[model samples]
Target: MYVVVLIVVVVVVVVVVVVVVVVVVVVVIVVHVVAAAVVVVVVVVVGVVVVVVVVVVVVVVVVVVVVVVVVVVLVVVVVVSAAAVVVLVVLVVVVVVVVVVVVVVVVLVVVVVVAAAAVSSPCDHASSSSSSSSSSSSSSSSSSFSSSSTSSSSFFLSFSFFFFFSSSLISPPFSSSSYQSVLIVVVVVVVVVVVVVVVVVVVVIVVVVVEVVVVVVVVVVAVVVLVVASVIVASVIVAAVVVVVVAVVVVVVVVVVVVVVVVVIVVLVVVVAVVVVVLVNFEAFNANYKIYALAF
Candidate 1:
């Protein structure tokens, strides 16, 4: 009976040992499978996430590049168009100013010539009348040399008084002669022409200077505006890129946190299951040990 009991106990112990080993092996295998599964899931998720991030980054970069190119092209076109417009405006202004100045010069010249001619006409008529009157007086004096010595003397006195009075009334320079009057008129006309020409040249120079200044100012403003616009565009592009990078980083961090949480949860559940299995198996082994002791 003792031998039979011992043999039976030995057999029971062997079977229990075998069961515990099998359970342990099964748990280990399950843990390995779970770990492998978790690893595969993590790898797959990470690979997909990496691909998505790369694609997004590439797309954003491409978009930014395209936008920058388009903006640059637009800026160039605008600058060129503005420069062309400024040039055209300057040309038009120059042409208009020149035409106006020429017209004014022509009109002034015509007016001066007319005025000079009108002033010369009265002087010419007066000189001609004086000459004719002197010729008549000379003829009369010769004819009446013997018949009118008193009359000639009286006529000469009256003529001298009349000439003196006329000379007092008219300025000496203008009263000189018709030739002198014409020469004075010519001088006046020439002086006037010279003044007009000088004025016109001065006006043209001033206008040209003003035009140059305006063109310079416009160019400077355009350059400043372009520079400012470029700076703003560059800043915007940089900000957009930074935002995209930050967003990608945030997404990656969130994904990593979620993966870590899932892995931690899986590990905790596996540990709990292993602990429950171990507890149940130990209880069964204790019950079998008590039974073996009672049999002994």
Candidate 2:
């Protein structure tokens, strides 16, 4: 019974150990598989994010550079055109002033010629004829000067107006610093994205390493437990066998002692019975001999 119980205990322990080991192995495998899947997912996500970030950065950089270039070119064109307009305006103002001055000077000359003509008398025919002829020539010259000055003044005013209108229409309002700030912001964003990617990669690597180590430890522990359990089961079986062997030896010794005692008692009883028979036969012979003598 004890041996049977011992065997049952050992079997139970072995079964439990086997079950525990199997469970541990299965758990470890599942954990490893899950960890691997997580790592793969994280890696894929990070890769995709990195790719997207890189593509976005490239596009942003290209766009920023192109925008900066375009803005610079546009600014230069606008500044140059503005400067040209200013120069043209100055020139036009100067021309208009000059035309006004020439017109004033011509008006003063015409007034002087008219005054001279009015002051001279028509008393001397030869002198009157010569004075009339000088007045007529002066009037023609003054008229010609006045017409030319008016035309030049009008032309300059029209040119200045056109330039002012053109300048207003062509120049952009935004500053160069605005464009610089935009570029700076784009660069900072790119840097931030790169940093984030690096951080994510580091985190993923750490997590994977931790998961692998944990799985290894679990597997090692399970194996060690199985080994320890096997050793214990073997020891128990050995102890049970030893107890059964001791019990069997004790039972055999008791049987041998009982058989020896029974044989000794039977031999003593037979020896006593023989001694009694011999004594009774001797007494009977003696009594017969006495009877024979008396009869003689």
Candidate 3:
């Protein structure tokens, strides 16, 4: 009966676990679908924003173009109205006179600019022949030359309000109508020349610095090689000197040993000769005494 009850409890637990897993799987699928929907909504909203921005830019550009066209048309209409009124009242519109005067002035300045630019090329530092030409022009600026410079100066003086009164020493109004433009050109040329000179100087300095560095590197390498060579030569000379010193010491030691051996042999020979002489003298005395006794 106990084994039967255990089997029934295990079956019930297994069924509960399977039902919980199925519910969890269904919930996960629903969450995934909802997340996908939210992503699609966000993408649609971004596309709508981009389209709205494009529409606003187009509308603004059209409005600005329309405003500009309206302003231009209004100006034309007002100018035409003023000119018509003037023509009816005065028989000749003052606007036409002003336009003619401006056209004439512009044509004159254009002609002068062309003539001056063509005829007056700057002091040709490039040519060796220009100096003589410049000198002749200066010399001919004498008391009575009806040169263009003086005539143009007089003409400008009468037209302008200031040159008519100022003395030459005080100040002269520029004679050429293009005097301001000429001054600007001269200033620009001078600036360019100065810049060129400065750049050349900097380049020369950089080249010199590089050359100095190269020379220093070469000298350092030479010094290191010489030092190494000197070290090798000194070691060879020292080894030779040590070898010679050792040989001389060995020769001196051998000569001293031979002299000690000779001194020892001479001392031994002297001792043996003294001992033999004493023995011979003693034997002769004994024999003489014996013969004397027999004769008596």
Candidate 4:
């Protein structure tokens, strides 16, 4: 009976031990599987987050670069265009001033030469008359010579006075019969040249201005359109519209100002040229008239 009891106890103990070992092995296997699954899930989640962050960073970088490039290009183009306009305007002004100076110099030189010639001619006539008077021995011949000289001198003086008055009234002091035609021709040529130069300068300025304005407007509009297309925001679109309107207004104001300035310059140039011509002619006439009066 004791051996039977002992064997039964050993079998029970062994069975209990075997069952506990089996349970422990199963628990270990379950724990290992759960740990592996958790690790795989963590790895997958981390990869997805990393991919999303990289994509977002790349997109932001691309957008920023594109915007910077567009802005830089626009600014460069505008600067170049403005510089060209300024250079052209400066060159035109310099040319106009040079031409005017040259014309005035030529006119002054001509007046001096003509006045000198007129003064010398009167002196020669007086010397000749004095010589004729001196050579005469007979009183009768002397009387006749004196009378002829008096009549000739009187007629010449009257003619000169009439010419001077008429020239002042009709042609601003260039009505001497000998030189009237030449002086008129010179005046006409100078006026025509000035007009032609002014017209050419104005035309070039207008064309260049128009081209620049068109290019600027187009660029601005294109930029606005691109911005509006890229962004679907109402505030952005409104701002773009406002910018375009302002740009247009500014362009219009610039064009108007430029036109007014050009017109003023042309008018001033014409006035100065006329004044110079008048002054030169008047001085020449006064000098010639005084010389003739003294000679007679």
Candidate 5:
């Protein structure tokens, strides 16, 4: 009687386990169906967001071009002229080339993507279906050949390369850890560049301000404004003469030196502009990196 009772208990436990498994499976299926609906909704929202982003980018490009016409022309002309004359020719300053390449590459990306979506993809889909089917079937067979001699063609080709390609369109963007690393590095670089540019600009401004202050004091000595100005002006000029001009011929050199200050200021502005450009554009970082690498 005990043996019979134990067998009955075992059977009851098996039935309970089977019912629980069936209930769990049903719950899992329901959960998955809900998850699939949520995923579809998310994908639709993402598609709309992408379209909005593209529209915004197009508008921004148009507006920026229209607004920055003169400043763009000035910077382009001055930078181009400076870039054209290679200092020592040993310095292969390819700033123009780099700018051109950046612009061209961005334009090409826009063009190629537009052409691929508008013209080529539909044609490619029709022409390459058979090759795709054959490849998929072979791959499926290799992975699951041992399981069944009789499997449906649909079962073998459960995957579509079209959808595979569609997923790949943004899969790297959506699910890649590398993307975050690259973005973080780029942001860090940009921040560092901006900080460096601000510092350089501040330094240049301070230097220029100091020079202007000195020039103001120098001008005070040579003024004829109401005689009080004249006295101060005379004293400063006399001081200048004592320090810089000992002989009559020294006057010519001093005049030449004064004449050259205008050119020196222009050169200074150019240097400041260049420092601003290099720091802001991340080019100086690359040069420094290369130098450090060579040193090692």
Candidate 6:
């Protein structure tokens, strides 16, 4: 009975732990799903920001061109100087490119920060272990993974910003030939940044899916083991109960048989004693009668 009770207690504990792990896993899955939604929202916001930045750049360019052209025309009215017009146009284009580059960088930084935050958020690592030490180890590993991913993302963002800023500063001056070149470079940088962001998002998503899959698989295996253990425990308990009952029955039968034999032996001894007494008494009476007859 004691062994059965202990087994039952153990089964209950294991069941409770399994339930807790299941709840944790469900929570983790929900968190990951929310992260995914957050990523989508970030992407959409980034796109809108990019559009706004482009519009701002275009408006700035048109305004600068119109202002410079007007100044040049007024100068033509005063004293015609084609060289001054050319210089003014080149200066205006350079200023516009600089503004556009700054706006793009700021937008890209926003995107990077948002993406990094999503990746770095603590993921619930609900690992079931037969021991506390193993559980702690799994938790540490998960934390380390999150930290590494976060650091790598930060490094990538910094490197991208440095590259864009440095290349812009070192590139040729803004002129008719270099204008298209600079614009191409800026577009390329933007595209690369967007692609990198997308890739990181994909990697984070895959990690979440894999983690959830592993949790599910572990839960299934634990359940199967628990069921098997319970079955074995039940069988052992039943066998123990049967053996105990059989032993008690055998002991009772032996005790009754011993009591019956003792009773029978006492009865036989009493009957023998009584019969001998009656025979003795009758013999004595016959002896007396014979004597009396002789006297008569």
lDDT of each: 0.41, 0.38, 0.36, 0.49, 0.36, 0.39
Error of 1 at 35 (Å): 59
List the candidates' TM-scores in order. 0.29, 0.24, 0.22, 0.44, 0.25, 0.22
- The whole-model C-alpha lDDT of candidate 3 against the native structure comes to 0.36
Over 4 Å off in model 6, which ranges? 1-173, 231-296
Question: Can you give the lDDT of residue 244 in candidate 2?
Answer: 47
Answer with 3 or 4, whichever has the higher TM-score.
4
lDDT per residue as tens, model 4, 88-161: 56655665665576567556655754564465456557655654654563355667777776676666656555
Question: What does candidate 6's lDDT look like per residue over 119-154, in tens digits?
Answer: 332211111112234444556678776566556555
**Predicted model with the maximum lDDT:** 4
> In model 4, what lDDT does residue 84 have?
55
Using alpha carbons, what is the TM-score of model 6? 0.22
C-alpha lDDT of residue 294 in model 1: 69
Structural RMSD, model 5: 36.5
Residue-wise C-alpha lDDT for candidate 2, range 88-158, written one tens digit per residue: 34433443444344335434533443333332322234344544555556566787765665565555555
Model 5, residue 149: distance off in Å is 21
State the displacement of the C-alpha of residue 113, model 6, in Å, after optimal TM-score superposition: 29
Give one digit per residue, the lDDT tens place, for model 1 in 49-74.
44456576754454355445434533
Error of 1 at 61 (Å): 1.8
Per-residue lDDT over 1-296 for candidate 5, one digit per residue giving the tens place of the 0 to 100 score: 22123223323332333233233323332332333233233333333343456575754453344234423433443343233222212112232233244335434543443443433344455435644555566666765652342243334333344433443352221213333433343344333333333343333333333333333332233222212321333434444442332222234323433343334334434544543453344444445645776699
